[model samples]
Target: MTTCNYAAPPFDHPQADVILRSADRVEFRVFKLFLSLASPFFETLFGLPQAPDGATDQETKDGLAVIVMSEDSKTLDSFFRFCYPSTLADDPSLENLTDGLSLLAAARKYSLDLIEKKVCQALANPKVLEMEPIRYFAIARNARLAHETITAARYTLRQPLIPAQFSEIELITASELLVLLTYHKNCSIAVQPLTKNLKWLTDHYGGCDACIWLFGPYYKGSCGCGQVADNRFSPWGIHPVTWWATYMQEISELLMDRPSGDTVRTAADRTIQQVRSMGCSVCSSTVKENMTEFSNLLALKVDEAVSMIQLEMDF
Candidate 1:
């Protein structure tokens, strides 16, 4: 039960009736009535009768109540700054996402759900999750921000995060962490079959005689049927077949490197670029259409696999 005669922060209103002191002894002289109006939680707290002998309070001077908070002075100032717009000349400084999240936690601790939601919105903007997705995943999951949780989880999937690297595992629920791991496993398994249908482009869509001129006659001579090549024994050009082979290999590599819908699309795009380099009208046009279809199918499969984890998104 120690108390200090500390001066209030610079923004403290002169007519404030309550003093909030952080663990480090910094003081914020904020108004009780304004806080109560903004949050029913504070109103209910203020409605309670004073503790006998002011047991929970550090000290009350000049008829103003002094309530000591467990948060550090920085967090208290940040939290109060958002609650009191008059104290700030600029928009609430929410550049530090972790601090914004911590302020939300403090708000929720005291049932300031209104402010809690505002903080959630603030955290949703900017590069918070991108900065540290695994860490953001842990925080969002704990805060029960379902959309943010899934967004961070998606980013986490792309990272090389190890369980040992996460310092805040205790903040993440076992079930939630299991769900994320399950999502990674399912996506890996789902993308295993993500190979382009080589038969469809090569076999089914065998090139016509004129097609070989554009593709370069990869085969030596025309068959008795007046066709330059059939995909089974002869391809009009090496590029289409080579492209599919390279694409399949890329798919396998991507499956290992986090084969999300977006990553697979990039792989498909690269494959199509290589296919175009062959300058074969038949190969370029056919493969472009087929690759688009394949990418869509693979993306759908990945999304379905993610759905199995049931970590539904909020937006």
Candidate 2:
């Protein structure tokens, strides 16, 4: 039998006090990693000069501070472990579940690619898997964002599943499923079921842009890549995997019949009156609806429109 040599903390951990006192400082690095991975928030932080390979300890420390001071505590701690592996087993005074989750949330919210990858490795322990939902939520949430590399890493870290007991499979929720699907974009096994579920949503809700964008290719017998694949529909000029949210918005507008000049005027008047009556903010912005909600409303309107048109046809 092959055995694994995992890293563990020593009996007399010398840096325990420094690790605890400066725990918040440790999160700064994690924040930097998160900012680097997410595109929208990337520009907020300024760049730092790289430390020379043969630079003295003081030179390296000074160089790091330029970029490090702007980062938060949660981010700092996450980055610390990656730079110094021995610090992994340091027993910090983790006050509660919230503290741990807050750190994990920062990782996910900022899309800290490297930290997420490492955390997924720690989560592979069976003991960790059996923890409370709060703990599992953190792991699942991050795992959903870490991309395919994390999934591949996890296979080595944990035991394989038994195919015969497929029914006994532990299933993730819709939100969780979305995360997993987003992380492992190329996994056909995972993508197929999600596609099927989205198809059902389309059949029932018809005008839901989110569902349409999510599973449009599959339903239309094309792929998002514009390739004519088996049982997939190509979303022309749309990148299905990345711009799913935007695609749903487009589909919703189409279902709403593009709201003509007359329709827009009527909708605007109604919206103004409704907002005034509620005493809320002015109707400065256009009303936006999710694909699912829009689809439902569209189906009803289509039914009514068809009924009205039938009388004209009959006459």
Candidate 3:
């Protein structure tokens, strides 16, 4: 409490019973009652037997006991805000993922159950989790936040595999990384069968006449454009429309790289071009609507399949 360089506001109440000093020498004059109520750590600390006359060599300033904390001023400021009554805002903005993780660590250290819960909720926010999911996953897994870890891991599937060098990799163990990789691999495997079966595409409707002419063996007449060379084996046990086959091929590759519904939702340029190039004017005129409908169903099916692949987290 030497020369009190900084006193965080809201916590700087003049009538505060104790002064919690940060590692950087900033002081937060907070009420012991609030801290004790919110944290068992503080309760136990204050319950300790006082020195004779309560005057042992514990640091003091202005007649209030000074408790030095290892956290910096900013972190303690956020922690105390949560410990305070509902008069203050319930949630404080943690500037970045690093700050969120720092607050989570501090909350856990102090055994502040409510604050830890709030921090976990904030960390799980989509805006926060989607920005850098792998980093969030590493940090959250290291912190042992099972929900946040799983949420972040799922978000990771929307992007390619984890890069070789990310800053937060040090926070997680090899086993943690392996679990996520396995989950991604499982999701990828799950979606492969989806693309291999054209029955889902044709189940609801008769084959498109344009597709049959341009892609299948029903080539009765041509609209001038030559038929696409669709020699690839069809999962439908019959030749799939060249355009549909191409679309499936591209999306299946995309799903393997990023095993998520999002991968198939955005139709590939190659598939669209292939559709437009079809000899059937009907297929070209209706490609937009048809692809939208098909891709939506495909994306939904991909999500359903991925949802079944459980991410095994060792919480």
Name the 10 consecutive residues with the lowest summed lDDT in model 1. 219-228
Whole-model lDDT per candidate: 0.63, 0.35, 0.75
Candidate order by lDDT, decreasing, is 3, 1, 2
Per-residue alpha-carbon lDDT of candidate 2 for residues 1-315, written as tens digits (9 for 90 to 100):
232221133311333211121222331222343234342234344344445667734222213332323444544454344434443334233343444445555555545555555555454444444333223433444355333323322331121221122211243345543442333232223223322234444555455354443333443454332212323322332334322333334333432332212232334345434434543221112122333343444344433332222111100
Q: State the lDDT of candidate 3 residue by residue for 1-315, as single tens digits.
A: 146675756777899898889998888888888989999999999888767755688878898888889998878877887888878535577647777777878998999878887776776777776678898888778777788788888889888875557888988889878999999989899889877666666664466552454243344443333434554435434555566666777887889889887777665445566667664665666567667766777788888988898888878
| Model with the higher lDDT, candidate 1 or 3 | 3
| Candidate 1 C-alpha lDDT tens digits along 1-315 | 665545445446687788877878876777777678767767897788877773665468666787778888777777776676564423366766668766877898877766776676667664766566777777777777777777778776555424446665778767777777776766566555444333333443465443342233332342111232334323433443445555666676776657567666778888788777766555665657777876776666655555555453332
Question: Order of all candidates by TM-score, from best down to worst?
Answer: 3, 1, 2
| Cα error of candidate 3 at position 251, Å | 1.7
The number of the candidate with the highest lDDT is: 3
Pitting candidate 1 against candidate 3, the one with the higher TM-score is: 3
Q: For each candidate, what TM-score against the reference?
A: 0.62, 0.25, 0.78
Q: What is candidate 2's CA lDDT for residue 293?
A: 48
- Answer with 2 or 3, whichever has the higher TM-score: 3
